[model samples]
Target: MGGGQQYPTTCFNTVIKTVVLAGLLAQKPFKHIAGFTNSLLKCYAPDLHTFYSETMDHIHRWNPNLRCNFSATVSVFAAATFNFRPQTITFPHLDFANLAWGWCAITALGDFDPNKGGHLILWDLKLIICFPPGSMILIPSALICHSNTSIGSHEKRFSFTQYTPAGIFQFVDNRFKSEKEVNSTEMSAEERAARVEARKIRWAEGLKMYRKCPSALP
Candidate 1:
């Protein structure tokens, strides 16, 4: 993904999110990207092949439709396991599902550097993730937000971030609505007072780390 893509608004906590992102980002290259597991003599039965097989199996279980989007089909494999708030309102185009462990092939393993290419960011209280490939992490479905930085055009980045049963909601639109409403109208005296109360509520609601987007990135 690039700069234009964004993730959903989350109600999930930060520490748990940090743990998940760090786990995936810290995976050993070979285990993170299956192709590295193939020794010279074992080239025929490469990790890529095994990973694909496993991914297909997991997809079948997670999505009964067996549907694969154009973008999703092109990237290497990866899987995220989490539970979502079924009762909360969701974006219209986003998908959610449970995934089996060891799914998806390595898309871009050991190929990224912090400075060279755009990085993966799991944004919540702030930008909390930078995935390096092959390591697996679990995040809360309802709270984690993720997106990648822009990469060079000539360079190849085969990573894919997917949510099964996708297209059920559109997350960006919701964020836009909230952001616009908060920015557009001028606040009346009473409204301004109420806004302060709202802010206080957010602070009391364990959103102490609630943050504004970075000027350089957003």
Candidate 2:
């Protein structure tokens, strides 16, 4: 709802608007899940969460007319997805359109035994995590290769996810304009060269935002 690859502006999905607007028919089932995931985002990735929240707020402030249900319902996340195909399994892939440093919340639901199936396969990390129903996991969807193992034939599974597109952050950072708009203006030789150098330093600074703790990786 916030932003997507196809369009540079903050917008809504027509299909989702008609279907799974989180707080549409009252906040009963989805609100609690959204709130809990928001808390976990603050707990596990305080700085990242803060950055994303503030940026999303800035986006709203910048685009006062934009109305998105997911961001209004979830607050911190820009978009939400529902994967409910009875036997919900995915092939390994990276969400390349999402923010590289941003975390995506994934919650598995319905009847599935973690021991038998429905395990999160973090291919790049060489780890297979047990994913039980109602389990919420946060991961760098754009940076990591991940998927899930198949559940039993008779078993059923559904998933809800929240995420932000890299274009959203880019939109805010480029002074409320898209990269294409920013690039349209001609840059002087010095300006171009300076920006090239700044990118390297920004990458290093970006790494610092990942807070370190003794309990990390444990």
Candidate 3:
């Protein structure tokens, strides 16, 4: 998040955005994993899905060799994670880093009885859903506080999650420039007011892009 335009950005682990144009990139075998997730997004939230897909395309156009094209379609998410390393129940929290109106995909895995434990808790909805193994669900995690129940000590539970951070969108919307670059520039009062107004409109503009689920995945 601290990187400047035309520079590589990373979080040491789970995220690495580079603009290096040199070297041959090896084929990512997990393209199918990403592909499947993208399909889920398309099925439930077509408009939001398109937004992410187009954003990736825009990224490629912004930097012809930014090293972000891990898959042909760029899939959907900027990042994916596995929660299987050590089974633990996630505490209720909002994924404030993700785009507030966009979705985060979640899939349950491992051996755990849904009736006994490992239910998804949507705090705002006041619902504790039995998340079946291998079932996938999408939610606006940035807007919702959610978590899950702890599994039995003898049982195992894992989760897969996909999301793109709001910073990535901010970076793109700022024309690939970092916030510091924009803020440090000298501007007239009118220009400053315009920028503030633009910021104010972003949330409302984004809300317009949200869509209801078309139908259940067949």
Candidate 4:
């Protein structure tokens, strides 16, 4: 969580991941996590539940062997990875693995000034949002370029993030096959054209899902 490393990448080392995952399962902190995610989905992204269910259902149908990270009642997927930042400023970047249509939830914790510290910077939206302790936000992480502003040197800051990877859904859809295998599959010209068109439709649908949200920043 520290060392200024980004996760779902090497920055989140194995030791930290193992400890955090074990704690979550043993403690069942998902009560708070689930409550926050569901409330945000209901208020800002009304259609998110439908989208998440549909995606998960599709994955289950294609690959029965695959399992979602979390129970259906808790989260859309097991939290991809949790990021723990301690009074550190992050560089602006987009999450490549997150689904463009899915929302990622982030909650701030620890002691920091609300008015002048630990603000969220949404580069594309041009917003420097106040992020007070215990406050959470749900946004399309894969689509938005975001980072955090600096907190006071003496004050402490920490945050927890939850997200699902689009690649996981794609993997399930491919019947648990690797990406290379899926790409190597043979297809007729007509079939290839149809597949390409289908991808375009799905991409457009994903964009619409983001646009339809009443509050994209929440």
What is the Å distance of residue 5 in model 2 from its true position? 6.2
- Runs with alpha carbons beyond 4 Å of true place in candidate 1: 1-110, 133-135, 160-218
> In lDDT terms, how accurate is model 2?
0.77
Model 3, runs deviating above 4 Å: 2-33, 68-74, 212-218
Candidate ranking under TM-score, highest first, comes to 2, 3, 4, 1
Q: Once model 2 is optimally superposed onto the true structure by TM-score, how far is the C-alpha of residue 204 displaced, in angstroms?
A: 2.2
TM-score to native of every candidate shown? 0.28, 0.87, 0.81, 0.78
Flag the better candidate by TM-score, 1 or 4.
4
Q: Considering every candidate listed, which one attains the maximal lDDT?
A: 2
Tens-digit lDDT track of model 3 for 47-131: 7888887877776677676445246464767666667645658999999878999888888878888899989999999999999
**Displacement of the residue 88 alpha carbon in candidate 1, Å:** 29
User: What clash count goes with each model?
Assistant: 16, 0, 0, 1
Q: Say which prediction, candidate 2 or candidate 4, comes out ahead on lDDT.
A: 2
**Candidates ranked, most accurate by lDDT first:** 2, 3, 4, 1
- Give a tens-digit lDDT track for model 1, residues 1-79: 1113233222234998867755653555423233332221023323423444444454445445633322232323333
Report, for every candidate in turn, its global Cα lDDT versus the true structure. 0.36, 0.77, 0.73, 0.69
Per-residue lDDT of candidate 2, residues 1-218 (tens digit)? 23334334545458856566544424656677877888777766677878888887897887777656444535588777778788789899999877887888898998978999999999999999999999999898988999999988899999988888887887777777767667787999898798679767866765666884435445
